[model samples]
Target: MIRKCRFAAMLAFSAMMSTAALVQAQAADLLSTLNSTHVLTIGTSNDAPLAYIDPQTKAAVGALPDLLRAALPLMGVKADVRAVAMPFSSLIPALQAGRIDMIGDGIYATAKRRQVIDFTSNTFYNPEALDVAKGNPDNLHQLSDLCGHSAGTYEGTTYVDQLKQASAACPAGKPIDIHLYPTIQNVFADLTAGRLNAGVVDSSLSAYALKQNPALSFELVADYKPADKAGSACAFGVTKGNDAFLAGFSKAYATMLADGTAAKIFTKWGLTPTSFFLSL
Candidate 1:
């Protein structure tokens, strides 16, 4: 009985020690380690103008990726940023699990999200917009206009909540038909096929889609709610409690904003410097 008891205690102690070591390993400064290794693994998504796999080059190209490439060098580290494409909803969890070092896919830094992840200061402001088929069949100009019509939005995006708000306050008490998609591309696809009357997405994405494929037969209604442009200001996301990485990233990101590197990238992706550098 005594030997069995000793063995059980030893096992428990070893397990606790292993857990502590794992916690310590995860608590190391990510920025310093990346600086030493000259590599960064970023979790991203297929959101155009933010982060997506470029069709031509089959490489990740967008405002967020470009900004990271430019800003990391400012942190005394010349990093080769490798963006791994995943669903938008998976980015945060992956960061927390230490599967990815950072997220550069234009994750909005909302108060609720701040509890689970750390973000650099506001990098860009994306106003909500309605994307409709060519000729504006439904004439859906804004969020309110979606009432009594089908609306498409991606899961885990601010746009989903925006649509729901519009639905609840619909003047005629007609709830908007909400359709959830796994990705922005899925929403756009359904909208294009007339499966959905409109899709609520970032204005920048609407513009990029139209610019990239003029024959897509889609039109953007920018400033959907001109009077109240209630939208998220997005930034890069890191693990929630990784203060070391957050501080270093924030400093380097601020430098990028000051040096016009961020603006240049956003402009290349069809966003104005004023919109992208909201709180620069």
Candidate 2:
């Protein structure tokens, strides 16, 4: 009888141990599925301040990356910033394809883009401007001056739309000849080569370019005015249906703004401090 009882007890013990092992395995699997690897992929064309490549490190390091780094940790996310060098036109398609998780580069929220991808709260505000050649040969002062002149702009940008609108309103026989380039550098190169009369771009970018090329002597001839009072606010583009990620990001971003961290980052990059969406 004693030997039988001991055998029964041993059997029970073995069963409990087996059950515990099974439970642990199940728990681990569940955790693995729930905890996604946090990676924040940012697309860039190397525009300064907004998004640019560090010449020495050859890595994307700019205001956008800094802002993402500050905000991600608050949501218990470990952000891995990956910079994908691509043309501005390809950014939306890349986001839709899941090639990138988000765009760290500054992108304005347009009604057309909103149809495809959702934009997070505004991170910065940038005005569109024109870059004219040295000595202001054409004496260009605004969009009206582009009439009958060849202008260059990055493909797939709102600047193209602005140029088209301006062209439509010009007098007969003075239509604007706007040239599109795959990259900003290409457009600048053409402008310098005299292929283009002017290069229209974001004011911040125009400032940065002029600073880099002292001899280029380019100046902003016009500033873009958004159709709405909201102005042109830059935001991160995220895939639709990721409500959880968006909510978390917004929360983290709000926290950063409330605490002045966002302002510091903006100041570091020489950007004007502006309120994030939540603060507004």
Candidate 3:
């Protein structure tokens, strides 16, 4: 009986080591798969100009998708990139769970996140802006303007914390009424429908979204003052310690940046690419 138990333990140990070796081998040469398999699974959110599933064609269309399709092949190999759309809050967990190979949801690689995943050089910087009904009906020109008014932002964004902080600073009886939505598009929907008094929006998204829907009732507060002038640094995410994927991707991206391919991608998406925003 003891011999049978020992044999069973040995089999379990062997199986565990085999699985570990397989995972490590896969991690070691993600770049080579670009040539042989030609498929890279990218996880993203339903955010426009960064990434979103097109309603008509049902394919991912945006700056990051375009850049990946254009730039990855410049690495001297073929790369067939695919984008998987998920909720804004599900991106990181999806990446960590290995449900996707990379994340391109305009995700920021802050210090806390860097501990779990590696990131290529920043892809963009997103500054926050304010939006309100036309003619500035609520006088919502700044963070302080949120008091006594219903305001909202996309969930899982740093902007949510900013809105909360602003709300906490409001007077005891008339705090900012804050709400969170699954996507920025939903937040804008509320604003246009007159359900939300104001919304904290991304500046680039402000241009792309409002331009796409000129008939929306709300308008960007062009002169809205913000508590923080500097915005967030956004990047593409991959599993931590995957050096081949990191080095190969960063090299390909740098090539695009030098050749103006990145700029054209941004311009086609209605936003201008900048060195300050797109570089190390």
Top lDDT model? 3
Tens digits of per-residue lDDT for model 2, 1-280: 9999999999999999999997774344211222466555678877787777787887768888888878777867775666887889888888777677677776888777889887877776766667787767987877878899999999988888888998999999998998999988888788887888888877667666776677664565644333433556778887665566667778888888789888888777665434422233
> Quick one: how many clashes does candidate 2 have?
0
**lDDT of model number 3:** 0.80
**Can you tell me which runs of candidate 3 are displaced by over 4 Å?**
1-16, 19-26, 225-231, 273-280
Q: Could you give the candidate ranking by TM-score, starting with the highest?
A: 3, 1, 2
Candidate 1 vs candidate 2, TM-score winner: 1
Question: Which pairs clash in the backbone of model 2?
Answer: none
Error of 2 at 180 (Å): 0.3
Model 3: ten consecutive residues of lowest lDDT: 271-280
Over 26-115, each residue of candidate 3 has an lDDT whose tens digit, in order, gives 566567756777887888877788887788887877888898888677667676677898878888899889898889877766787888
lDDT of 3 at 13: 99
TM-score of each: 0.87, 0.79, 0.88
Clashes of each: 0, 0, 0
lDDT of each: 0.78, 0.74, 0.80
lDDT of 2 at 270: 61
